[model samples]
Target: MGRFRPGAETDRFGIRIAASGNGVHVTLCRPGRRPCIWLHLATAGTVADKATVDDRPEIAALARRAPRLEARALECVRNDRVLFHDLDAALEPGQVLQVEGPNGCGKTSLLRILCGLSLPGAGEVYWGDAPLPEVRAEYYEALAYVGHRHGVKGELTPIENLRFHRALAGGTPDRVPGDALAHLGLEGFEDVPCRTLSEGQRRRVALARLLMTRRPLWILDEPLTALDRSGVAVVEGLIRDHARSGGMVMITTHQAIRLEGCVLGRLRLGG
Candidate 1:
């Protein structure tokens, strides 16, 4: 059995809990009908605990009440015409939000607004409880963005680019740059300048930064563009893993995204 210490987190019932492993053991208490949860290791021959309220989809949705990113009544206008308006949304941990719409429907514009690169014509974007401007430094530290234009520097090799990215992040890297490159299927091409690589390979280089940064929030615009089937699968896996680990993602893509084991929400623009 895994031991659980007191954690700062509390649910609606004010249950204090700490977690360390895969299994959850809950003991029901009488009188007030409160429940105590125990953290358990997944050992052989141990009867796996049945799904509890925390595992139920409906309860999980209610439990995700804290917003990491929120947009309230956001309106976008280009060429003096409103593209989208009255858009209120929030991103919580372990959630993947897919922004979907037709061409010129302001999907990219919405992403830019959420990223704080572009402002909405009306309304506001907030990180946690405060507006984005007030928490720019802290928010950016947790943000990783990939746009339609591949951000890879053409003159730099994949390894060099990833190293530069790590330096900019200013922390101990989660993995070596070469390892990230190879994981993205750029094994032999790690030393070659990004300028000489194919467009798909360049896209892979930009995507590899996501692995190295390990940021909690990812804002991706057309992340699957110019990639083969295998590359697309790799990105899907990355997004799924990130969400499973309690990371949030905001992505705009025309392709259907197949994900499992996390809450997925779709926001349609210009509809």
Candidate 2:
């Protein structure tokens, strides 16, 4: 709805079109009524008005798919000591990599570096042979980072939290809240305030965002910290589906997760 304008058209479909910052906008025009009907269509990659109705669905489908991850490390130094000396790792499409180590190790730090939220002290992170800084925006557009803290606000309901996250991330919240809550087994409590929910339920809300975003790379720090068996299964299934859809995942957790057909690698940080 940001900066949109309507226009008349004489095309075969007899439908008027609108222009918006998000993407192409479509509207139906009648003889007398002043543009009684309107529809807004947004696509992630490109914009086009000539697309058919069927094409719109296809574009939406593509947007739900995840992108690939290509992170490499050149070197890393911290406190005059080498943290990751010439660390170089590449995760192919549809693969999952785990960073395992004891507490106080650099697992979280490395994840932050990969996410480009923090720069490595003396190393280079890359997204397909290109430095992360050069493509930081692109990385942000393609990645979703879930840190130790569940990012849900206590005052907001589960649905409201997800809606806020989707809006901030530039994603359509039309189905995100519903889909995420349902997937995380919070359908009945979707409207309940997060503060009223148990710790596990709060974690569920954060985990639900994984299904809603189109981001490919998921960097989770202790993603399963406060979940029961069922909750863990839900997250595990989501991870499998994410990898199957050509997405990349980097996780740091004490719990062991086993997935077939998933290439697993580990980085032991501390002694």
Candidate 3:
């Protein structure tokens, strides 16, 4: 532990400290005050002899910066009637919005509507004041979606799978660097065939796309299924950094994800 500086920076959700002990502990969290994961910054004694803390003044300057909401909706419904009503909400860039509820509660359906993959029965969804369908191309360009499936090709190698994903997403092949694979702890298996990988390893390969895709909005469904502690840390860091950089995220998970400084809005199904 080190001397804690509370409220040192406004936009900063967590604190950075220069620890005199073995290492500095950095906790990644969502804006909703939930703990996502923890990061251990090894002290200078390990790899290097000394380290310096970056000045907080620059971070403090961002305190006044507010994220702009790019999406707005008046109401949402399904099948020409109200499935879930009064869905008035605004999603700001750089915000992490979590959707929680029981099974078949329209959580996934709602996300589909938001992403314009499906249309709302009655209400409308807008992207920066324009109708979602009108800006579908622009919206898709800014969005990255991950559903229940890992979405990786079983016949392709890890690198090949990532390359295919990039191509399908209209991005150049090999756009994702090798570091992305290493970050997910998939160093040796980068060139290995996907079918031979374990379930967890396959999931890691799918998750590796998060680092590769730089889309602004992340719509994820149950993203933490096969991840271990370190894998969870990687995802948490990705979410934190995405929000900090003015990107938006919408995630639905049965397990609790501890996040801090996030403006949490929820839609509970079945009441």
Q: How much lDDT does each candidate structure score?
A: 0.77, 0.69, 0.64
How do the residues 1-271 of candidate 1 rate in per-residue lDDT, one tens digit apiece? 0111223444322333332244332322222345554333333423223334343444344333334899999999999989999999999877899999999999999999999999899999999899998999878877889988867999999999999998887644668988898889999998989999999999999999998875779999999998899999999999998887567999999987788776899998877
Instruction: Evaluate residue 32 in candidate 3 and report its C-alpha lDDT on the 0 to 100 scale.
Output: 33
Candidate scoring better on lDDT of 1 and 3: 1
lDDT per residue (tens digit) for residues 147-238 in model 2: 88769899999988988888777733325588778988888998889999999999889988877666667888888888898988888888
Model 2 lDDT, residue 129, Cα = 58
Off by over 4 Å in 2: 1-71, 74-82
**lDDT score for residue 201 of model 3:** 84
lDDT of 3 at 237: 79
Q: Against the correct fold, how does model 1 do in TM-score?
A: 0.77
Worst 10 residues of 2 by lDDT: 1-10
Instruction: Find the candidate with the highest lDDT and give its number.
Output: 1
- Model 3 has an lDDT value of 0.64
Q: How far off is residue 110 in model 3, in Å?
A: 1.2
Candidate 2, overall lDDT?
A: 0.69
